[model samples]
Target: MRYLLPLLFLVALFAMLMLRGYVHNEILADHRIRPDASTDTVPERILDGGPVIDARGTGKPTSLDIPKHKLVLTFDDGPDPTWTPKVLDQLKKYHAHGVFFVTGANAARYPDLIKRMVDEGHEVGLHTFNHPDLSYQSHARIDWELAQNQLALEGAAGIRTSLFRPPYSSFADAIDDKNWPVIKYVGSRGYITALDSTDSEDWQRPGIKTIVKNATPKHGKGAIVLMHDSGGDRSQTVAALDTFLPELQGKGYTFVNLTEALNAPSAHTPVTGMDLWKGKAFVFAVQVSEHTTDVLVGGLAVIGVLVFARFGLMLILSFLHARKVRARGFRWGPEVIEPVSVIVPAYNERECIANTVRSLMASDHPIEVLVVDDGSTDGTADIVEAMWLPNVRVIRQPNGGKPSALNNGIRHARYDIVVMMDGDTVFEPSTVRELVQPFGDPKVGAVAGNAKVGNRDSLIGAWQHIEYVMGFNLDRRMYDVLGCMPTIPGAVGAFRRTALERVGGISEDTLAEDTDVTMAMHRDGWRVVYAENARAWTEAPESVQQLWSQRYRWSYGTMQAIWKHRRAVFERGPSGRFGRVGLPLVSLFMVLAPLLAPLIDVFLLYGLVFGPTQKTVVAWLGVLVIQLVCAAYAFRLDRERLTHLVSLPLQQVLYRQLMYVVLLQSWITALTGGRLRWQKLRRTGAVEAPGGIPTQRGSKENIDRRPVA
Candidate 1:
């Protein structure tokens, strides 16, 4: 393959890459890249995610825990001299509270209306300085619009909005690597989207009841109903709030500020911690707007055309395997009976080895446990050998890390199908069964198990759990549906014996052997599947220190893998799938994501810091409010999602920064061409399991005559 030759020579080229410099600090000096590392407040400021609001005090304030329904009457695009005063009257008439998102321009024109918003118990927020096509504006222009309007809102009313709504709710005008960082800037502006749970369209001159019906929620909790008090002739909106406020209040709904109800602890009791909102908008955009299908297909087209195979034979294998899959009718039997070689590379894993070995034993599939005792000073080999497990076997050797140990085990492995799992992870009994099910088709080369967080109650674990579920799970499904599952995860992977042997077994050049094997499988013409239901419970780094170390290794390992496999960069087989599709994916993830992140981040900051023209910081805040809403929405989505996706904004501020650090460290190491030897994480916490049943082998005569894909 064209990719393989360059890859084998990659480590040798490390000196040249290093001479190029590890850190792209030029961007930092130019002020475009902020590492999110230093605490120094340079000219750079990350997007706070919403309008800088006077959230004087906010944290997990007591939420309104009562059974009563809590609703928010949110009016957007207002502070209108023509209609807002009248709307305030109706709100007062019912003695109810509401939130008014005022346009910065309108607020400048009508200061008293702005004052009335506060004086009448209505919270004032920004709708934008002039409500332009938010998407079309550059980050600089977005900031300018926000700043200009922020000044108007603050000047007119003594209030400084801690929340904002973009004029048109256009998420991002551009979808480029350059605009991703700006997502953080805009998000810091506010809490959620134009809380348009209700749509009055009062500007359209709808009838009074029609407007009211359009603006009111159908009586539910956590409903932040949207109505228009401005933006156009909003007399209908003014009257609608009047009509529905009393009726809804009569039905036991109490209205509160956007910062309240959801944060409040009791019915009618406000959520007091103002600082609770931390919106992070993780934006992903490109220069020109494109449809989703076009974007996805573009990747395949670009990659397929860009790469050629390094080895002709491997390319042929892929062609044959993919062809075989398309022609197969693999059936699902009542039980999966594939004999699997369970490869466990243990080093000082005495505590975890038995448990790890025992878990594999519990799986319903036929498994022969092979614990390769990589030089454990703690007598891990003795422990495993002592177990004398009926299904277990131990091979002790000098400590050579995981890949070396796995290599030793692979040579001695007894079965054609092998399952490799981390010693520290636990699995459901059905895990092995599910992992092997995809191989019912002979064409299937490998499968990655869904890794869920076992310690989710911990803050970091909860955060990562959300990430694994939403990110890994969703992307896997999306890729699987697309027939291109990249990056078979290291935590748990299943592979075919023939495929691994053909590729010379797991190479030790890359730290991420899992990723290496996955690429090899693709080159060899086997499908990589993500079995979401096949779950593995693993521990996440509980502290930042552990998080950093773990990520550093993963990142460096990936770089090494990329270097090792550079030969596959642009090679295609007669079928052209591996060269065209698979190799390109490697470049997208390995080369592109890190390269583009810094440029995009600083480009957004140029708008927020230098050009937003914030004679008053309030000007930039209104746009930030929108960011907060988007983040809140992201959070809610993660909460309800099966993959347990975390709030994109939160990850932007926290996890994304981690990526930057890892990238920098890995790049430096690559340049220096250093052998990595980082401290290993010692497992302290684990979920104790109940006893599980070990697998029993069946007679060879029972093997089915059905063809493997």
Candidate 2:
């Protein structure tokens, strides 16, 4: 059920985006009209017909003309908010009515205009939704356009219009072979095709005098005139109407709508019941989708800024960190060469415990390894006891959680400087030595070590390797510089025993004890720094399910840790610095960023399917390039091979989504007050030891191997 929530949310988001595209005329739109189309199939009678054409009967088609001294005024492409009301006002001033041919797209957006047209005694007609040229549309498309237009009309004004006008239509005499069939089909759909006898050409923004001249009939003849109330810059059309109405009225001509001019029945019929409700539902959906899309676009902009800001900060601060560490004679203060106590918390880690113990036993620094076996039913303690290596001891206890086991080991330790590691991790010989060097600075409390993915032979492992390098390690460097280092990895980290005592031992309040303790140390006025030279190789989860579980706990636990220490934000001195700086960075980069990162992919899909594909692809690839550059820089800093980057793009396509969903599930669990226990991943013991040497099962040959450097 938890997993299904994210999927359902995505489905709903996709649906809203699709609806937004449809209502905005961004999908399946074709607006071109062929001006030089063939006219061989057009009948001679239609070429000489009147403006009102009727082909609904089985016999010959008939056309009707307005009575002498009577003019029918028709406006196309409207119900526009800007100009349609102005045109209607002019008609009302003259106590006249005009027909408004509205496109469904515009009508749905500005339904009040349609209602205003009805309430003010104006006629509304169908101009085909989206304003597509009917001559180029299929029969099904024509039917859909007409039906959708009627639906919009029904929703807006509770009436269906029978008056029809194809987009780009002009004079009745201009009907060609390409358009004759479309006109007949429309007529068969029970609509009277309203073609123009005189065109004002106001759509071209011609001067008012030219428009009035073009729309005037010769010798007091009756005619149907075409002008526009929408489709841009209709000021000339509205001005022409003001003058044309009064001037023509003075010339003994009366203006009326199509029905009045033709002396025929009303072209609009009132609708109600299910049809009315369905229309309303459609309009409602479009409105909601439009508003939702607006909000998503705003979020996308914010995410974009956050992404760029994070990348900029990482690059700048990481360079500063590298320069500071690599500077000659730079050290974390004088090294004291103190012997450290190492703790390995084990629970059903029989497969990797021996290698973990062997690697620690070979550390270049003087160290005593204590394996705290927390009631491992798989005899994880037996594996370490069988090793019988010098300076390594296995302690057995009941199945307390990892925090309890670590606290037990801390109590039994004999060294002031302590190193903590996971049972499945193998550290380099110099890792402990390098990790403990940070403690030479009296103010330093805990040092976070560099953790690497050792099982990188598989695709999933390679992806994790990239993340560890690019996302985790690089972030640690930046955070270290900012004095707000959040987490000391459980795989490899060092702590001052005094600092540990000051913050009380590890708390079981959060699943991420590492992060929880690090924050506590910060609030207790201790410095947490990163040890880049301290590297540990650990097996990364090789399957999607395992990765999801591991990350789910990590993400949720981080949230819990953040919440647990939220009060630090209001504290004074060092605690305040970490709370204000560290907490916001963690919350942005770790939680909120991952949650909103999927918007990039969402818009990419939307653009490809709807339109503007070239721009969309370019934008997406641009983001990918930025990521690639950052990854390359991180790999260089870590001195890792760049070959693993071949899977980076694929990771963005597939693996990023998994991480996003995992983060989302964690958010859901946190918001709902759910509890999560320790989820142990099945380990294969495939991790390589320090110096890239593979660990062998039950092989004592390398137990006494000399420490490297």
Candidate 3:
């Protein structure tokens, strides 16, 4: 069910996107009208035939000329909202009937006009959807055009049209090798090709008098006069029609529909049953897609604004934060010289426990190391115990979760200031000193340290390394300036024992214990800040599966913590301040932003495949450039090498999608009231404490150093 829901949502989203592309004339748009070139395949009879040609007959194609003094007036490229109504009004004023050839795109958009034509005793015909030149189209394309046109007519007026006119068509004598085959194929599909006998050239917007003169038949002969009610300013056509209808009538000429002039039955057949319903369904889907696209576009605009606003805020405030921290006189009170107790929570972490413990013993600050073994089956506790190092204690417990183990460690600790880190993490020699320095301020409750990916040489690790530097650490700096730092890294962080007791230790209600406790400290009116110099290197997941599991838990847990503290928004004092500022920031940047971020890529694909490729590429690259600028600044602030950033673009393409899917699944699980358990990742112990202990994997000397209990 988890997998199926996201798949269904994506499929529906894609379907709506395609429908919007089609309706907006982006997909399969007609760009150029082919010019007359060859006539090698044309028969002389068709070239000299009358306006109404019936090539459906088995023998030579037959043509019918209108009887004397009878005129067939036809309009093309219509059902236009502006000009179509005026044409229909003029037709009604004269009590004249004409054939309106409507394109499927316009007809589907303005069905009322098509219905009005049918109700006013006028004829409707197909002019091909999108007004594409059929001479250059394939047979399948020709059939699709006819079928889609018929579908629109059926949906609009419950009738099917057999009268067809190819776009850019002219008098029958102009038929050439290129278009003759198209006319025949259309004929084979049961349509009567209605060519123009006299061209009014109204689309060119000639003078009304010229249009009227051009439309009049020579020598009192019957003819199919072609004009337009759409495709341009048609006031001349309307004015010409007004003058020509009565002027021709004064000359004893009658303006009749195409079928009447041809002496044939009505070309429109009433549709019923499933066909009618299907046509209505298609129209409904298009309407819904258009409206949905409108809403999505508006949302895209809003997200675009929010994204830029966030970047602007980060860039400005990060600069301020750097200046504030780097100032010559800046200090977090006097240097914190008190001894500290560091807690290491281990659960099946046999690969990295030795490095983790030795890193703490190597810290510049005076400290005691407590390795809380949470029921590891891989002899994780035995390895630590076998080391028999002084000032390091190995505590055994049942297989409780991380929060439970941390709470146990806190209860057993003897120092007022306590530091916590993951068993797979290795801290620098000065990390503990730097992390605890913030506690010199009496109000400081917790300090968040910078977490670096130690296994960053792998592709997945490189992507995560970029995210930690660009996304996570950069956000921490901005949040620090705002006084709403949300999450402290579980890999390395420091807290006051009094503050921990006041906030009831770590709560087991959320998977993100670090974030939950951090928020708790804020609500308790204690300050939580970021320490950029307190860096801890942890092994990042190397494979996609492990990354997915880790991020899924983190995403879901962050949401849980946010929801759990939602009431703080309405509370008074520090709680209210943090809630109003912290929660909204977290929700916007962490939750809503990532959820809607995919829209940029989605539209990029849409534009690349459908149209406007250059603009699309420029827009997408512009956004990428913005991200690159931000990332480069972040890397410079962290003082890290920038070569790993070469994978940043591919990370946006592939890695971000995996993160989006994981976050989406987390949302689904959260909303559905489904619970998730902690997922332990396999560690390779890639990180090591400098100049302390050689914890390399399968080192014979290190193994031999382990004394028997």
Candidate 4:
């Protein structure tokens, strides 16, 4: 049942294609002829014998069987603006009138022609809404087609007709067992099913003489001549009529409308107030559906163009970033051997507190680990104090969120450079040294560390790991080259103490304190650089629900930061560069791209159902190939395993959709001024610090090193 909705959507899209003339059934395809100048065509059959009635006659008369030289002229499949007007003029020239079998689609498009047909004393009848061969359709669909056309006829011409001529019908002889049910249904509805006696075959566009010869009836016999005023070029039919009608009149035959020729009541059917109201409503709905289908197609086209542009731009920028990285050799300026203050913000993170502090203590650079315990009920402070390590301080405070804890920790720091990390993250021994070296340039305000997922054995974790490398790290490289790096991950980032003080320390206005501070630093005229080698491994969510919550906060917080610094776009110098180049790119790839990603699925299904299968598959595979190439490049840059490519397609189908929904909900929450509380994820203790030290309950003996600031 969960799959039913997508199946229904695909079916509806296919029906729309049929309605919009993109897909046609065999009957329609067979009848559809292009109006080309070349006159070569198939010869039409000549009816020299008497008119043939249904093999199993339903007691419906084939013709008037008139004693006088009289005939009924009929046209089908029209109300065409071009050929229809010409046909009507020819009838008017000879003071003649004919019955016109009009399809609802064409009638709705050119109602003025239907009105002219009525005002000029010609007759109107029903052709199915899209000219489908009703023999193959279900009963409900056939009824719907007929009802919709009735409604359209009333709306367009202010009246309903009881005359209906099924498509693909040439004469009475053509109605057989296959079409018997449909004819019976129409008869039950009180409609007169008109059939032709003489086959004009003008639809074939044979020479004018052939059309006239085929349509001319036997001597002393009255007949109904068949022809079309729509579907294709009808000039041959119209020209044939100009010659045939006059010569027939000269031979003492009169052409009259269906009612007069049949000696039957007028084709206009009486209606009730209820029917009239219902008809008007149905007509309005059909119009809206047509317009909406067009809008959907146009929207899909726009989304395709945007997706292509995004892929192209990401490839080009990432390539340039790679070239720049290789040219500079991933080396920072001369190393700054300054003591760094590492602030580990914790809230209910007692499980990983000791491991985080131990990793910091083992850093090659001189550093003090400040584990700010933000009111953890699990004795997180006691666990840090039990370590008995040098230059490690455990500050206990009320639960004030991560930003508040970081601000408190930074205030008591005794170093010029600060490294901020999460309690669940463990850094490499050289992480601090590599992170702080960028400060050797006085203009550099902060350095963003490369974040890796440490618990990537699970499928969900693997997806997040790929995203960190292909999405986050690759984006940072592009951002670094453009000087528009917007985020410094809290997992591992280093900042100059003066730069933090200048930006008023960590901001509590957003959930993403790191991103908020980074944007603030950018606006304050400082360079935020990416330190690719400063790797920190952090535990990622292992379940879909947990991943959703974590990403929701991240997406929501990023939006807040972007909005907060929107004015930077219009500023001068570095701020303006970030606002114009960096901000737009982030917003495009982060927010807008995911928002429009659903179109890929929609178009994929549409193409599969209504378009060529091979082309659709090729196009889809082409997109996936491009993404695979990009992901391969990113993996190589991050020096990670390429086996993660096995999960890329599955990630697109599942993880990518989850991310899009998260971002969409975030947008909705931000737009509605809704407040979201920080959600603490369930810690699995799956990640291990360097030397395989699990921070669960035991593993204290792994922390043997003692270093000082």
Candidate 5:
């Protein structure tokens, strides 16, 4: 339900955009108006067919019935900067005036234009705000549109326009049964509705000659000529006026404003304080929305660029790391042969604790396994003690959490090198040896082991396996190359005891204690490296609920860790490298990328409905192809079965949304100052006992190793 609110809010925002014409209007047919048409184009004769508007009403008289050679020019949808000035100049050249019917939005934008219309002996009239077909709108909406337009006009030019024009209506003849009610309402409001007698269709961008011909009356008598100075490229309208105005003057036809042509006094009212404030508020809202839109679009563009840049860099660097690994092979420290202490922090992980211990006991390196039980009521400690392995020991602790338990384990460690493994995970026989080998470099303080998803026979597990192989592992290789490995998975990692002591052991400050500890190591000037061959199989959640809970902890804990070390970005040397390089990469790829990824689906659906179907399909397929190639490469490098690639599309459809939601929840929790507890997953114990199967693709001598599942 928490996720539902944000998703719905986003959908509603897009709907608002659609209504405002930012998104497609096909879904709301009434909001979609033809560019060149408004209610004002409706014939007046149709209104006369009913008792909609009395021809002898108090409304100002129209100029449809006029003397010979008298012309009335009316331009709708004006205050446009580009063509309005040109139109005004042409009219001024011939000493002519025309009625400018302006939409409220445009009127507010160019108040000087409205003032110029009145200043130069031209008439100003209301054309509503946003130019909707008032006949199709509700009564309240119609009222709001008219009232808002009146306020805008009064504020812009200190005049309330009584001469009104309903959008989509043209000549008095265009007023029809469909628009008669709206016309009647405006007439009731004491607004004289002006309609055209002739329309030039100048908005279609027809040649100037055609526009001139269309505007010229056949009998050279009285006519209100309809044209537009906005809503499109009105160059033809301006050009036609340049040539036609002089031609009309040569023919002894005098051009006049609507009021003079009709021989009626101006019905415009004075501006009021209330109208000014309302107009100001509306203008302020428009400005804020516009600026907000600019910022949002700019931010999205930045995020998109960062995401793709990280992908490109990681792909190249990961490829190089793989090549180097293949060519030179892994090297171990001679000192790594010393005995190591392995810590298993258990908390109600009884189902997989035995397997975890057995796997560690089978390690090729001399090691002692310390199982620090963090107040488990499920006999998790009993299970470990039942193993009775000589090198394995169990310790009890209060319910303090994983960090406290790990700290307890470190205190009991009797070796220089310490290995940490979750009680729910199993490792290969040589995993411990492989994990600590990177410490061969004295400066190397920590090793991040390759953690894989066990129990992958299920579809959910399969998706997780793919993520582990393609996303996390590939990222680790990239981080390793950049000398800024940010996390050492608690499922399997090795640390020098001295290095751990120097950083004050694991702190409970973050839920991701491993990440917190590793970052501290980096800031303390110790190099953190990745051990690709040190593979550990950990059980993944079998259900969506469990997955959500587990990820929420991981993500929230990671955020806490990042926040705690955020200042390292400005520090010197290694700390600065981790902060600048590692932190940003983690933030971009892990956090921001996932948050923005949902937009791809949103836009995909939008394109499916309102965009060119072929182009949308091609674009969507192009993205999928890139993902497929990346996944394939990651699988090849990790030596995993390529068959799992089949789930990639389905995972995108289902699993991706869940992960996005998890990240969002984590961020929300972090921002709201809400705390999240360590939520343990129910271990299914799907991993088998150590058997004679070599690591996925290694030697047969150490044949008793298997993949996570």
Candidate 6:
């Protein structure tokens, strides 16, 4: 009897769904009026949300009637690459743009074409991540659906979206409680503008002319026209826009973005006279707090290792890494045509500045070394001046910071090819030549040199040793494989002066000026290169205090750079095509990779902290295997010593905590609107050790030549 009841319910539900679908599809769609209409039809459809179609001073009256000659020709559920292009061609024929409510997944597939619509001055608005009934979705899914679409589509269309029309307009509106939460959520995410005008039930199978004829009522004002460009073959819809847009233009009407038409009233206008679209901002929180205990225990293990025996291990690893570089036997290939101008920015480093200058002086590549003293009070300028080598020049300036120093150097450098390096870093003899040689291609805007720790005598050094060998080098390689070299490591990166000038020089708006500059180069349509063969040695933070200070700036600075140039990521200009499409995506990664990445930490912590149990013990064993593979991979990438393997667990624990701590601090600082300070850390504070070039690979093999990029 119970089974029979359930079966009856299922059958009835299916029958009702079929009945509803048939009737819903059969209903006649309401007609909408466009702005570029003849003054003839004016008695209906001026609808809610202010002067329809921004008719201000066009002498068009509000709350007026619909126009008979007015036509809203629309395409919906598009854009297919093949057919969308055809449709765009047809629209271009008539100089018209339509409101496209696209599905999110398809939007990602044809990014360039979508960008084309925006570039041609058309409107591209959101239609959600996929075609889903909002009422049936959970609160989280609703927000994700909208956010993913905004991130992917807004850049393509070049317009910030405000018009949000439901798939069936009334599907969620009718479902009361089940759907309103989602609508409310979308509003919260800054999608408050609703479409009052609906046109074209083109999701239906209809003749091309019929789709156009049905929407072209005699006349109405401020009507939002809806169309699909991608549901099925939309050749007909494309053809209709071809015919109708010009006809409307001929009739003295103009097309505009739906949101612009509705919400963009003058500030002086009264609330009743103006329609202001209101929506909430979207927030996504990937939850992983269920494994808190494990994180604490793993963190303790990391601290324990930091307190002892870490330096001896760092020395061993650094030695091994240098040996690997030497084993490559000095990749002696061709000569670099360009003699490079290497700019070293020194803030207050008195200890390492002298050695860095000496290392570069030994380089055989025809080079000019400019030490930019950013108001160094620590005698860094004195040390450089004391060297007094003819090629070594010190430019003392107010402590405006790295970007300002680089900008200043850019004006003074006579050479077209410029290499920028940190004052704390020491380059190998041929490193400058290796880093510079890749600019044979005119498009190559910048190049990155591999950075290894010069002071590997502590846990900090060991951590950096592992980082250089594995994370830094490997991640960069992976990025290259993915077709982008993310940030050129700030220690030693080179750029062409031409590209720098094109992007308005480096901005002081960011803390990590290197990342900001690199991204700007891409935006200017230039290429960034990574040269694994070119290596520089930089001292790591030797203590907790030092580590925190450097990292705080790094983290906060990254956030600033991402924020400052975020607009360039997707909007196109001479230099912004790459930046426009790339910056937002990279920012997304910088934001998400941390919060969602902790699941792996959860798994590791489960094993490390609670591993007395059999399951927990098994997980720890798995961590051991993963760590070993990571160690070897890290070594291969950067050529580090074998000693980093034993210190892997402690390093991982500390690394995770550092990431979390920095992330939190960045958020707090951003919220408080605090300026990022340059708090100097102890540089020469490494526990004493005998240091030299990683092998006898320190030969001063110079190739004297003139600079050419």
Runs in model 3 with CA error above 4 Å? 15-32, 38-50, 59-75, 78-98, 105-122, 155-157, 197-202, 205-257, 260-264, 288-292, 693-709
| Per-residue lDDT of candidate 4, residues 1-709 (tens digit) | 2224435654665565545442122223333422222212211221222332222245543332433577778898887889999999999999998889887777766667877988899888888877877777778877877877787777666788877788777554444556656666766666766667888888899989999999888885888788889889888898898899899999998998767865767878656687777756555555555675677767667667767776676677778877765785555567799788898888888777777777776788888888888989988788887777667777888899999999998986789899999999999898888888889889999999999999998899889988999888988887887788889999989888999999999999898778889998988889999888899999888888888889989999999989888998899987887788888877877777776676566566656665666887787787778879888988988889899889998887778777866877787788768888899988866676785333333345324222211
Candidate number of the best TM-score: 2
The per-prediction CA RMSD against the true structure, in angstroms, equals 24.0, 4.3, 4.7, 7.0, 7.1, 21.9
Between candidates 3 and 4, the one scoring higher on TM-score is 3
Residue by residue across 1-709, what tens digits does model 2's lDDT show? 8688878877888899988888778896886877857779888788887988998878777888877898889898887889988998899999888888999988887888899999988889999888888888999999999999999888888999889988888887888988999999988889899999988888888799999999999999999889888889898988988899999999999988889888889888999999999888887787778788888888788889988999899999999999999999998889859898999999999888877887886789998888898989998887776655666667778998999999988988889988999999999888899899988899999999999998999999999999999999999999999999999999999889989998999999999999999999998889999999999999899899999999999999999999999998899998998999999999999999988888888888888988689999999999999999999999999999999999999998888889889998898888888899899999999985654323444445434321111
**Every model's TM-score:** 0.48, 0.90, 0.87, 0.78, 0.78, 0.50
Q: Which 10 consecutive residues of model 6 have the lowest summed lDDT?
A: 278-287
lDDT of 5 by residue, 451-480 (tens): 998889989989999999988998899988
Candidate 4 TM-score versus the reference: 0.78
Model 6 accuracy (lDDT, Cα):
0.60
User: What residue pairs are clashing in model 3?
Assistant: none
lDDT of 3: 0.88
- Clash statistics: count for each candidate: 85, 0, 0, 0, 31, 46
| lDDT of each residue in 345-406, candidate 3, tens digit only | 99999999988888876788998888888989999999887776656777788999999889
Candidate 1 on 392-482: residue-level lDDT in tens?
A: 7777777778888888878878888888877677767888788888877777778888776777767677677765664455445545644
Candidate 5 lands at a TM-score of 0.78
Give per-residue lDDT, candidate 6, residue 346. 81
Two-way TM-score contest, 3 vs 5, winner? 3
